[model samples]
Target: MPASADADLTTEFERLSLPLADPFTIARGTTETAENVLVQVSDGSHEGIGAAAPSTYYGETPATVEAVLPDLLEVVEEVGDPHVRQRIDRELRERVGANPAARAAVDTALADLAAKRLDVPLYRQWGLDPAAAPTSSFSIGLAEPDETRRWAERAVDEGYSILKVKLGAGRTAERLAAVREGAPEATVRVDANAAWTPAEAVAKTETLSGHGVEFVEQPVPADDIAGLRRVRDQGAVPVAADESVERATDVPSIADAVDIVVAKLQKCGSLRETRRVAEIAQARGCEAMIGCMVASNATIAASAHLAPLFDYADLDGSLLLDADPFEGVPMSDGEIDLAAVDRSGTGAVEVDE
Candidate 1:
């Protein structure tokens, strides 16, 4: 019998400092370590795991995630049923309201618990098609032109057919030239992380089009709806909204302005809301990308299960790590292999020392 049939849930969390393989820099800044809080839920037998990779860029830090987790866990305990996910989602929102990352940890953990109780993977629980999941893109952080060239070449040599290169702080032309010189055949995408003005974004997009880039993400400031509209209308390449589209509600306002909406569980607060954002984006005729923070496999696996519902994926957070304490779904040549995941739940197994 499944544990959800007679649920007795216990919740706990721990902070982990996951080191990066290289100093990961974006348009905003650089990060040598990713601070994630791992949350686990148990039903006396199997354990379900998830994590919160807090980003100061989104007004969350390790301290903030840790501070709010007790209340979030209290809600999980009070509910006492891992299967009652919608109720937990509602109450967690009513309770914490601000800490999206903290709530996401609990939500993902509970989802994993519920799915494991039934001995099914999360994508199976959601009734999603594994065949539909798009190939994920490996990200290359900002660096000098020579360094960018080397990493791009290395990623291609490592069998990543797709590469997401971070670009900003000027020298855009030289950096992109470096990438093209490195991996001319690899599918390339760029994310500026909201570092440009509308005019600057347009010019950059023109340059991106020249490079045969797939798309440019968050080119202008997040709040600049008018700027986004201008870029989408005037830019040479398609634009995707990552920083601007914070949740499902933000979808309607920006859907018409951009070609794609980027959804991240860390930003949305729950697995359910992430789906909502994708559904709403599709309904609005905008493509959706399942993106992630530089996080552990505990949470990346959770996001990977949702790839079947998206047009693109950027769940390469764990690949950026020096070492992850957990292992999740398998990826080969950037293909997310949810079908290859034999373990139930999110497939987030802890790595043994």
Candidate 2:
């Protein structure tokens, strides 16, 4: 039996309304903070940590997560070994209902604990090479032209080579132009957050291509597969599906419509599921991108384990926060320094209060 097998375990969590460095605005709305819940799982000796950021867009909130956590804790308590992470993840999903963020917290915590028991980092435990991971892109949420320009400038000054600019605020052309003006040499990727019609997306893609944009993400609503295909087929830049592809099963259906599929831990429910989505993208001949909700260090660290499998990475969720309760993976010069991750488990440990 594994060392973690049959070990007694306990779970603990806390609600966090983490402030952002600036108000985060997108096609949906504007928010001043990221609402999250942090969870820890322990087996007397080894401790593992995870975090969940609930999005109302996904029908989840801090309250819903808090409401479902007790049942999730009960389910986790029944597990004999944290190493059976996928089995535990499935059980949690069955017990927790439509709470992917909650399930992500539990899954990450258990995966962390399992890696801790083996005294290795989660990526190494998964047999991933940190050096093989691509550099992550810093995000510039929708803002005034000057403000957007400043964000892009700062990102470039900090050595970020790629900029992920949020569009779809009715000034798509102005926003993209402003960002390009701010960091003229930086590679750019625009996310419309499903705000455009197929025709609008196609037109904007041509305009944006001239500004040096590398790609466009979720140009239409999630359910509009035909619209997505229209944009992908007609646009100059490649189209990446974000809201359209949530599960591995959703991959095949949209594979022909997108050049890339964006996978997020909260949306996929577990690292295993996220990997499955990446594999599906690969099998379908589409590039894979790893994305994240506004999250804490624990979540970033956990997601970084799978960074090697992606063609693009937008995992700067923790960097957007006003304060991070933990630190694991180090982001420097536009890349997540996977070499800096030498600690055990998911390598996320809370800062001193």
Candidate 3:
């Protein structure tokens, strides 16, 4: 084992249930309960914590994520060296197959423990600063036009400058118009969650363009590469890919179609993998946006560490929760206080005992 490896460190996993104020609906599925997996690593002194949420987009349910906990813990216990850890991380993902969300939970915990061991924050490991946290957009799930508009207004009033509206149940135009009317000065973006056909996507983009919408996310299905390219070519607004760009392997194939790539730790399977996706997206001339599933402060705090490396962000998952477990990353008028976690590791304050 390498000198930096902590062979004595112990790992444990837990499941938590958090509630969402309203049902969160996207193309993949609906979420009313925030199903989270937390990883704790102890060296008999300081402890490091990391989190993840099971996402339906990746075929993950709470039960599935929970069921895989024992295997993930075994991998953590067996791996020690950082390089070996990284390789083990990859192998574990393959071993577990398509459970990216579960893989992410373990990977993030390992990274957090490594950083904490060195007394360095996770962002610094990725060449980011804790004092300068990233800004992120809050999401507005599918709702009636009036309700959506009111929600947008409330978000703006609460100091959120960017708003991501969930569309794709056939009211794209109405919703966009309502948002525009309610928060004219805010940066508004729409995500269709792959709910539209190519033709409908183009038509909806045309209708939404006049509202000064920032961009449209995954307007077409993830499998339709040609459709995404067509939407990009015809639409005045930029097209971003959420569901389409899942892994580093998928980056090259869809590079031309997407203007932005949303990187979620759950989708990419780890902080290392998520960083690789960001680098790949940037190299391919596509902007990167770090996002999260409906998660709590622990995962959101982890995502915030990577926010500065991206051009756009949608990481305010904690804000959507009815109650968050930990003290959340501080935000002031739409910007994260990067200085909060200037220490090593995730900078997560201890959840109340």
Candidate 4:
């Protein structure tokens, strides 16, 4: 388990299709299934696992991730050192700048492997305190007002106190009202997924404020920084930047325009970049939220390991699955219990089907 600059490593990957517990709909689209690519790296003794849940919104699909993973894994093997994660991440970025999810799979696998070598959980490897991690929020994908109410009620019954309700244009107010009616005491947040114009966003925030909405995420389109600023300047509720902020460098540019920067591991390319995004968001006087796509624990676990650095977390990706192929971090009542991760590495391992 000792570190080696000239270590020998092997890598491989396979496709992972996960069925959603319910058809997940957002403003952009609906998903009954999630396509992911699982990446594995080994040093003959220990194997590290990770998966990429590619999103078309980010311009990457399972096909794209599968196509680029070989090249990305080649970078990992070429580096020949699991501990030199920065170098592997750098080369992966230099090799393929577009497929952040693909690069993320490789980087996560390597991090898991390296952490295994050190015999410590990833958060411990990063010198983070488990208790500092914020509670994660459960998501309620866009559905009918009655159905949305049922989802909220179910979530509350399952011990989730925080809810992230996805909203589109039609019947949004009714849906949120149902959520409130169902779980009146639960903390509520809404994500428009950039489905609205600036004016529409402002109006929605006014309406959402009445429903006790904590904030609105990606109210306007990704390219509309001015629209974001307009909403922030005029809306009753504060705004969060999800599509608007992709990486660390992006945070500074959009920081003045929004109240929160949402960082996802796959979107940011690697764990390091996601951390950088968090740091920059904090430094820029914006709150940081760690989020993830509808993914398995393979990648979500690694993302959760960085939760101590963020002000908010929406890492219920695996929780939304009908079942997950891999197991990683465990969430209880929405709190990502990093302290419970006794296994070395990220605690992400494929379970028997």
> Residue 137 in model 2: shift from native, Å?
0.6
> What is the TM-score of each predicted model, taking all chains together?
0.97, 0.96, 0.93, 0.97
Off by over 4 Å in 3: 1-7, 27-29, 81-84, 129-134
Please give me the total number of clashing residue pairs in predicted model 2.
0
Predictions in order: lDDT = 0.91, 0.87, 0.79, 0.91
* Candidate 3 global lDDT: 0.79
Instruction: Note the residue pairs that clash in candidate 3.
Output: 120-344, 120-345, 121-344, 121-345, 130-338, 131-338, 131-339, 132-338, 133-338
**Two-way TM-score contest, 1 vs 3, winner:** 1
- How well is each residue in 262-334 modelled by candidate 3, as lDDT tens digits? 8898888888788888899999999888888888777777777787778887887877788888765676666
The true-versus-predicted C-alpha distance at residue 315 of model 2, in Å, is 0.4
lDDT of 1 at 343: 95
The whole-model C-alpha lDDT of candidate 4 against the native structure comes to: 0.91
* Number of the candidate with higher TM-score, 1 or 2: 1
Screening candidate 2 with a backbone cut-off below 3 angstroms (N, C-alpha, C), the clashing residue pairs are none
lDDT tens digits by residue: candidate 2, 1-353 = 01122348878888888899998888998888888898888889988888888888788998898888878877778875788876787788788768888888888999999988899888888888888788899999989899999999999998999999998748777888899888999989999999988889988888888898999999999999999999988889999999998779899999998999999999888889999999999999999999999988888888988899888899999989899989878878668777787788888988899
Top candidate (lDDT): 1
Candidate 1 stretches with Cα past 4 Å from truth are 1-7
Location of the lowest summed lDDT over 10 successive residues in candidate 4 = 1-10
